[model samples]
Target: MSITVYPARRILTMNPSQPEATHIAVDGDRVLAVGEVDTMPRGDGCVWDERFADKVIMPGFVEGHSHALEGAMWDYLYLGYFPRHDADGKQWSGLKSVEQVQERLREHAACLPAGEPLIAWGFDPVYFEGTRLTRRELDEAVCDRPLVVMHASFHVMTVNTPMLERAGILDGPRVEGIMCDEQGIPSGELQEMAAMFVVFDALGHNLFEKVSSPHVLRRYGAIAAAAGVTTITDLYNPMSDEAIDAMVEVTRSVDYPVRLVPAMGVLQWSAEEGIARLQAALPRSHERLHFGLAKLMTDGSIQGYTARLKWPGYHDGHANGLWNAAPEVLTELVQAYHQAGLQLHIHTNGDEAVELMLDAIDQALTLWPRADHRHTLQHCQVIDHAQLRRAARLGVCLNMFANHLYYWGDIHYQRTLGPSRCQRLEPLASARRLSIPVAIHSDAPVTPLGPLFTAWCAVNRRTASGRQLGEHEAVSVGEALEMITLGAAWTLGLDDKIGSLDVGKYADMAVLDQDPLQVAPAELRDIKVHATVLGGRVHGGD
Candidate 1:
C-alpha cells in the first residue's frame, strides 16, 4: 500500500507519548507514524500531502452529545435568539422578538407547498423575559395549515390551532408536558417528548424519522466537516431498520466526512426489545458507522422549566419540573442495559435527575459488577460536587452542556437555578478535581455544533449578556480542548481508535489556521478551521 505523509506547520497530536509533531505518515486510513518528516516511516511509494503545510492540526474533534436532527432541522426555518450558520455555511440571522418570530413563520409558511405543515425550530422563550409563544400567536402566523415551532431546547414545542385539532391534543389525555390555559384550554405549548409525539403523529412526520434519510445524514456530515469535527454522535436515534441501512450506505462512502455514532434510543422500546435490537445491530458496526451505544432519557430541559430538580426548585417558586422517565423506569432500564453489557448515555439535566441516575447506576454496577462501563450522563447542567463524587465512584462519565453557559447562563442565574446553583452549572473544574472522566458538548441544534465555541464557553464561562457565570468552575484552555477531543472520545468509548494521532489509530485530524494553545482564551472561538482530515481524506480545505 502507498503511504501518505501530511506535513503541517505544527501538530497537536493529543497523544502524550509524542505530544507534538511536524508531520504525520498515514498507511491507508490509519496512522503509521507521527513525527518530524525525517523521523517518520519511509517507504518507496511514499507520497507527501502538503495541503495542510501552513496549518496546525489536532485530533479531529469528537462531539459526544448531539443529534442528527441538527441536519433535518435546517430544512425548516430557524428561529433562534443567536445567529447560526446552516450546513452550507449560510448564516441565518437571529430573530429578536416574538413579533419577528411570527413574521418569519408567516413568510416561511407562505412559501411551503399547499397543505404541508410549517415547521420551525430553535425558538427559546427565556430570552423574551417571560413571553411564551402560544398557539394563538402561531394561528396568526399560519392558521390554514398545521404549524409547529420547536423550542431551542427541543424539549418543548408550540403549535397552531390547526395542529392542536389535527393532533387531537385539545382533548388528549392530561399529561405533565401538555400546557393548558387558565380555563383549561389547550395552549398549544407541548413540553417534552410524549406531548410532542402527539403533534408529530398528527402531522404524519416524525423528526427522528426525517433525520434518518441519506440526504439529511450527508448534510449532517457536511455540518461536522465545516466545524472540523471528524467524529460526532447522533446521541439519540430511533434506530429503525431503514435508518440503520441508510446510515450504513451513507457512511460507507469515501466522501462521507465524519464517523457517525447513532446511539439507540431506549425510550423507543422495552428494555428487552432495545437490548435485542442493539445486540443484532452490533455486528453491522463499521469504521465509520458505529452502533451499540444506548441512550436513555430521564428528564426534560431546565430552561423549559421541565427538568426535575431537587429541593428549592426553580428560584422564582415555579413548581418542580417533569420527568421523561419515572425514577422506577430509569432504574429498570439502567439495570437491564447494564446487565446486557451495553454502554449508555443517559440524559439528566437537573440535580434531582442526576441524583436519581447516580443511584440507578450504583445499583446496576453493584448487581452486574462490570468493569469500564463508561456509562455517561448527558447534559449534566445542574449537578453538584456531591453528585460529582458519586459519579466518580460509579465510574460514570459526564458530557456537560457547556454551551448552556453562553446561551442560558443569565436566565439560569436570574430565574431557573438562582445564583448559587447557576454558578455550579456544568462545573468542569469541579469534575476534574474529583477525577471524574468528563466531556463538554454543544447539544447542537440546541446551541450550535462547534467544539471550539463549546471549549470557549468552558474556558471563559461567559453568558450572552456578558456575565461571568462561574470563574471558580472555569477550566483552562488546555483542559477545555481535551474535553472537546479525547475527553469526548473517551465518553463515547472511541478513545483507543480515533482520539489522537497515535500509531495504529485512525488518521483523523482538524486543520486550523491557528493553534488553539497559542491564542488568547477569548479569541479561541475566532480561530478559523481551514479543513478536517477524516481517516486520511482531506475535506473542506481551500
Candidate 2:
C-alpha cells in the first residue's frame, strides 16, 4: 500500500473531534491519519511531503450551488460588471455602462464573420441608472448578424432585429415576457423562460439551459483548483445521454481535479424518467459523481424581475414573476422523487417561492415519511425568521446565495424590496439562530465562484455601495468558514464522505497563504489560495 504524509503550518480540519493538526497521512486517496509531524504514529515506507509546510491548510471548500458552465462560459465573450479572470489566468475588465458594453461588443463583433451569431453573457441593466440595453442599442453594434446577449442573471435576453426575425417572435403572439413598444413592435427584450426560449431556439446554443458540454467541466475544474474547492455542484444539469456519458468519463478518471455532484434537472425529464435515468446511472456512480440529488428551479431571479416575491411586489411594481411549476405539480414532483429516495434541491430566490417549496417538501415528506431528506432550498435568498424556523422543522436545508448582498444588494435596497425588507435579505443569522443547517454559496456565473468571497460577504454584509445590507444577519468568520466547508457538504448530502478532514474520509485540503480566521474579515477575499489537495493528490502547487 502507498502512503504519503503532508506537513503544513496549521491544519483547520473542520473535524470537531481533532479540529487542529500539523500533519496529514494519506493512504492512497483516503486519509489514514491527521496529527503533528513529530508525533505522527506511522509505520513503514511512508513518504513525507512538506511542500505545503509554509502554508496553512484547511478542509477543501465544498461549494453547494454552482454550475460547471462558469468554466465553459469563458470561451464566450464576458461582459460582467465585475472583473473576472478565466481559467487561462486572462483577466477581463468589468463593464460599467451600456456605452462600454456596446464598445466591447462592437470590438468583438468586428472579428466574427457575418451571421455567425455574436453571443455574449454577463450583461445586466440593473446596475445602470437611466436606460437599459435594448434591441436598438444592440443593433448599433452588429446589425446584420444575429446578436443575442444573456443577462448576468440568465433570466433576461436582449436580441437584435436579426434574432427576432430568425425566431419569428417579432409578430408572434403576445408572450408574457416579451416587451412591445407604442408602435406595437416587439422591443427585443425577452424575460424569463417563455420569451427567452424564442431566442434560444433561434440561436441553437444551450448556454442557459442544459449546458453539459465537456469543456464546461474542464474549465469548472480549473476554476475550482484555483479557488481551492474540492467538490462542486453543477446544480441544474439537463442530464442528456451525451452529458452523462461525458460526466461519467471525466469523473471516473483518476486525475480529475475536483469532484462533481450534478443534480439532474427535473424539467429535462418526466418524474419517472428523471428517477429512472439517475437510477440507471446509479450502478456506475463513483466517489467523484454522487448522483444522490436532483434540481427543481422554483422561480427566476429578483434583479431580473422574475423572482416570485410577495406583498408590494417589485418597487417598480413590475410583475410577481414566473413559477416553473404550480404548487400542486411541484408537490407531486417532490413526492415522487422523495419516495424514490433522491434528495431534491429546489431553486427558490423569493420568499413566496420558498413558501411554495416548504409546502411541496412538507407534502412530500408527510406522504413518504423519509428521514434525513437534506432537501436543500438553493439560493433561499429572501428568507425570514419564521421561514427559517419552518425550514428547520421540515428538515430542509438552506443553501443561501449570500453573494447577493454584493451582487444585487444596492439595487435591491434601492429598488426591488426597498430598505426595510432588503436589509433582511438572506437571513443567515436567523437560520443559525433557529439551529438550521445553512451553507453559503456564490451560485457562480451568477456571482463569481470564490468561497472566501462568499464567506466575506456573509461576515461583513456590505454591499458595493458600502452599505451594511443586514447587520443583524452578519455571521462570524469561523461560522462563515463552516458554511463553506462542512455546512456546504451537509447541504449536498456528502457530509459523511467529504466535508471535514477525518480518518477514512477523502484527504482533501486547501492550502492558503494566510489563515482565514486570523485575518480581518474584509481581507478574506484578498487572501490567496496557493493550491488544492484532492484525495491526497496535489493539484495547482508550485
Candidate 3:
C-alpha cells in the first residue's frame, strides 16, 4: 500500500469510543490507521505528510442538505449580497428602509443596459420593519426598466411597471397570490406560491442553464474546499436534468476536492414515474457522485411569514403560510419512494408542515416498514416534542437548519413565531434525546457554509442580538462539530465510507487553525481552515 502519514496537534476522528487521535495514515484514497503520533505504525514504504504543528485535524464536513443550484446562482451573481463598499456594488441586500431600497435601485438603474432586467436578491421586508414596498415605490426606483427584487425568503417579490406589463399582470384571470388592495390594483408585494411563480417565470431565470456552467461549478467547489467541506448533499431541482448532467460532467473534468451527493428532485414525478426515474438513475449512483435521496419541498420559509404554524399564527397575524404538497399527495409520494428503497429528504420549515409530513411518513411506514430506511426531514425549523417522537418512531432523520438561529433567529424571535415558539426552534437536544440522528446544514446562499459558524449556532443557540434562544438545546462543541462532520455523513448514508478518520474510510480531512472544541463558543465563527485533504490528495494548502 502507498501510505502517507498526517500528524497534527489534535485529530478529532469523531469515533464514539475513541474520539481524538494525533496521527492519521492514508493508503491512497482510504485511511490506513488513526492513533497517537509517536506510536503510529511505520513502514519502509510509507510517506509522511506532517502538517499544522499548532493546528487541529478533523474529518471534512458533510452538508446533509443544501441547494447546489442556489450556491451556483450566488457564484454567478455579482455577489453584492453582503455589503462590501465598492463603486460597482449594485446590491440592496440589507437596506433598512423603503427609501434606502429606492435610492439604491434608482442608482443601479441609471447604469444598467436599457432592455436587460435589473435583478436583485436578498430583500427581507420583515427586518426592514413593517414597511412593505409597493409597486409605486418599485416603479419610482426604476422608471421604465423591468425590475423584480425577490424577498430573501424566495416566497415573495416586488415588481416594477415594466415586469408587470411584460408578465401580463395588468389584465389576467386574477392569479392566486398577487397581493392587492380593495381596488384590485397589483400591490408591490407578491405573496405565496402563485404570485411567486408568475414573477420567477417572467424573470426568465432558467436556473439550470443560467447557473450550471464550468465557471460556476469550479467557483463553488473552491468555496467548499476553502471552508474544509469535502462533501455536499445538493438538494437538487428535479426538473433540471440538464443541470444534473452538467454537474456530473464537471466533477469528472476536475479533481474535485469536495464530493457531491445530489438528492434528485421528486416533485415533478408521480409515484410510479418517480420510481422509474430513480431506477433509471441508479446506474449513476456510486461513491462520490450520485445518491438516492429524493427531495420534496413541503412549505416556504419562516422569514417569508408563509411558514405554517400550529397555534395563533404569526405574532403579527399576517398569513398562516402555505403547504408545498397536500398531506395526501405527500403520503402517496413518500410511500412510493420508501417502497422503492429511496431515501426521502423533505424540506419543512413550519410546525404544521412538519406535523403533516410526520403523518405521511407514519402512514407510509405502516404500509412498508423498514428499520434502516433513513428518511430525512431537511430544515426542520419548527419541530415540537410530539413531532420529534413521531420522527423517531418513523425512523426519520432530522437535518436541523441550525443556520436559521443566525440568519433569521432575531426575526423569528421578534416577529415570526414570537419569543416562546422561537425558543424551541431547531430542537437539537430533543432530537438527541429521542435517539433521532440529527445533522446541520448551511442551506448556502441562504447562509454561507461555514461549519465553524454552524457549530457556533448549535453550541450557543444565540441570535444576532447575542441572546441565547434555547440554551438547553445547545450541544457540546464536540457534538456540534459532529453534526457537520460524522453526523452529516450518516445523514447522507455515506457513514460506511466517510465522516470519520477511521481505517477503510476515505482520506477526507481538514486542517484547522485551532481546535474548535477547545475554543470559546463565541470565537467559533472566527475559526479558519488551514488546508484540506481529499482522497489522500491535498486540494489547496495555506
Question: Model 2: per-residue lDDT, tens digit, 205-321?
Answer: 767553566667877887887898999999888788887888888888778889999888887678999999978877767888887678988789999888999787888777788
Model 3 stretches with alpha carbons more than 4 Å out: 75-93, 192-194, 208-211
When summed lDDT is taken over every stretch of 10 residues in candidate 3, the lowest stretch is 78-87
How does candidate 3 fare on TM-score?
0.93
RMSD of each: 1.2, 1.5, 2.7
- Model 3, 243-285: lDDT tens digits are 5666677777447778878776676667787778767766765
Count of clashes in candidate 1: 0
For model 2, where is the 10-residue window of minimal lDDT?
206-215
lDDT value, residue 41 of candidate 2: 51
For each candidate in turn, the TM-score is 0.98, 0.97, 0.93
The residue-level lDDT of candidate 2 at 301 comes to 93
In Å, residue 70's CA in model 3 sits off its true spot by: 4.4
Off by over 4 Å in 2: 173-175
Q: All models: lDDT?
A: 0.90, 0.86, 0.77
Q: Which pairs, if any, clash in model 2?
A: none
Could you tell me which residue pairs clash in candidate 1?
Answer: none
